[model samples]
Target: MFRDRGPAWRQANAGHVSLGQLKVTSAIESCRRASLGGHVERSEDCVHTQIAYNACRNRHCPKCQGAAAKQWLAEREADLLPVLYFHVVFTLPAGIADIAYQNKAVIYDLVFKASAETLTTIAADPKHLGARIGITSVLHSWGSALTQHPHVHMIVPGGGISPDGTRWVSCRPGFFLPVRVLSRLYRRLLLEKLIATHKAGRPYVFGNQTPLADAQAFAAHLAPLRNAEWVVYAKRPFGGPEAVLAYLSRYTHRVAIANSRLIALDQHGVTFRWKDYRVEGRGRQKIMILATGEFIRRFLIHVLPKGFNRIRHYGLLARGACAGNIARARELLAIKKREDAPTETIADADKPRCPCCGGRMILIELFVRGETPRHSPAAPTRAIRIDTS
Candidate 1:
């Protein structure tokens, strides 16, 4: 689709697209192509050789995230506690989401800070868990249909350490926290910070939101949202630590749409699958067709500001305190070390294999961009076998 419509779409929406988005598009289009250069690998057993091109490695590139997700999940496996984990989502109202589109760096950072503070504040309250909890928050800017629906997905353990850091304070068997309470506090905290940010003239307003540049106009624009009920959804607790890893693997490195979801791209449009959360059962999985230009526009809108870390850890899971906190929690729970855990270290996933013989493919030659390899196989092949491990 990009090969056919990319140039036209960029020309039409030249003013709307950002340089970062353009770079992402260029990188993804050139990924695994001869223009980016690659290496030659020969199979250990069968002498089967192929030219493996370099991936773009853009975080938003769907083709590049599979290996990243695996590596990330492997690291997170150690961070998981034995207790039940909860999946909580903090969503912005339509009003806020629109503003966030223009002032992504400021608004998105506020979303993380506001959501993290809300969780930590509520969990530390005497009425609630009254313990210091850890949080893993991931920002997702798009909904299933590739629409701008900014939200944060939070993974939290069902328990936390006491204020004195003496004992573990666990929630009741099934419940994590009151969604209504979380929603109300989250709404209040975010709006307050947003108002402050606006007053300080930090958030940028553009295009349709140009009027919001004025203080009065922006205040009036946000007035209706103050009374609106923000969404704070908490799904059922995951069965175990392993289940949490399984869930994170899907979401942590997800792009707007995976290649597997593409059904067709032709004169009709770009057809893909999207889940309608409003519907139930089998009816929820529906097909959507969008114009190539519209699809590209939606995808580009989700390109995050450069240097923004979408995945953040707060409280006990924070970088500085994570190790100590995990140890303390385990000790408080009287949990024993796993004797049956895998003893071997994780193997490097970069190694490719031969398609025919299923043996390790060793790198034999390297080439620069637009340069041909010194040695070519008897039967030259561009299709390098991908390792599924």
Candidate 2:
């Protein structure tokens, strides 16, 4: 179906090299083997790409992210809370940078487990406005610059249904968990676990470094983060239930950026835009051009280890009785059934909000042929507007 993935993607994998390309090839092979039954034959000439069997499109695959986004939103419809949802991000420090790369499977798991565990345990404490909260944690391994910045972005319901599952307890506006406290606890959890791994000799293979060979060096490397505050950046909550669903859409099965984000891929390498967080507000919106090789390097850094679950549901949202509990929550909220469940598809963009402004959002324009966005007179605007012009 994707005969041409734009010039940059094609050139990045021009030699059929890079981990992303290889993973894509593997996805195609797997899709062919795992039959989705078959599509109905048409009397009219088939317009859609009919290359072969379709991808199961698990979230982790670069190729499968599109399909996975659809399936994820459909299932997430059940978990939506009547109250607002917070966007909380927990990032790992570079103290364990090399280790996370080599042991992505294990370390990424620790990131998710620790971040979720911290949010739940803290929220459950009476001192911290005690209540059990449900969480959807997604692991992101790259920064906008394409560096290995492994972190977990959690979409947590602002308030959890009370322990008795009668009513929801909402958090104050602009306040989720305190980031400073969350950072301290998260740092401790990861360090303690990393130490245990080193002690067990299972995951730590500190190759050919006398300094790292000794536990003191390892302890010192981790010492900074002990007092050093790891970051827990909490974004403002989405406006309401629909906004929360839209928030999850951007992350569901996303790569560093979509293939379409890539602008060009001639011998000059690659040219694309990226956000620069060092600046505030609109200043952060900037375009970065990189060598083709560098683009490959950055994208590859985000490639998760095999079988790693980037998105995880925990607490009341966890599998087993948790699924039923969410349904009960739905009942309490006076919400009805998911009538569109059987026919749901991800392609419906649903005017998901602009990440910059927590205002009403709709696709203003759509692109074709890898072209830059052209402002047409017929373009759609938001229910509310923040003058970008």
- Number of clashes in every candidate structure? 0, 0
Tens-digit lDDT string for candidate 2 (105-171): 8888878888888899888876775777888888888888778888888888877767666776667
After superposition, candidate 1 runs with Cα above 4 Å error? 338-350, 378-389
Clashing pairs in 2: none
Q: Write the per-residue lDDT of candidate 1 for residues 1-389, one digit (tens) a residue.
A: 77678888889888878999999989888888889889998889987888888888999899999988888887888788888899999998998888888889999999999999999999999898899999999999999999999999999999899999999999889998899999999999998999899888879887888999998898899899888889999999999988898899999999999999999999988999999999999999999999888899888899999999999999999989998999899899998765665555445455666777789988889998989888776475456799999
lDDT of 1: 0.89
Error of 1 at 140 (Å): 0.6
Off by over 4 Å in 2: 1-21, 24-63, 164-167, 207-210, 331-389
Query: Once model 1 is optimally superposed onto the true structure by TM-score, how far is the C-alpha of residue 3 displaced, in angstroms?
Result: 2.4
RMSD of each candidate relative to the true structure: 4.2, 10.6
TM-score, one value per model: 0.94, 0.74
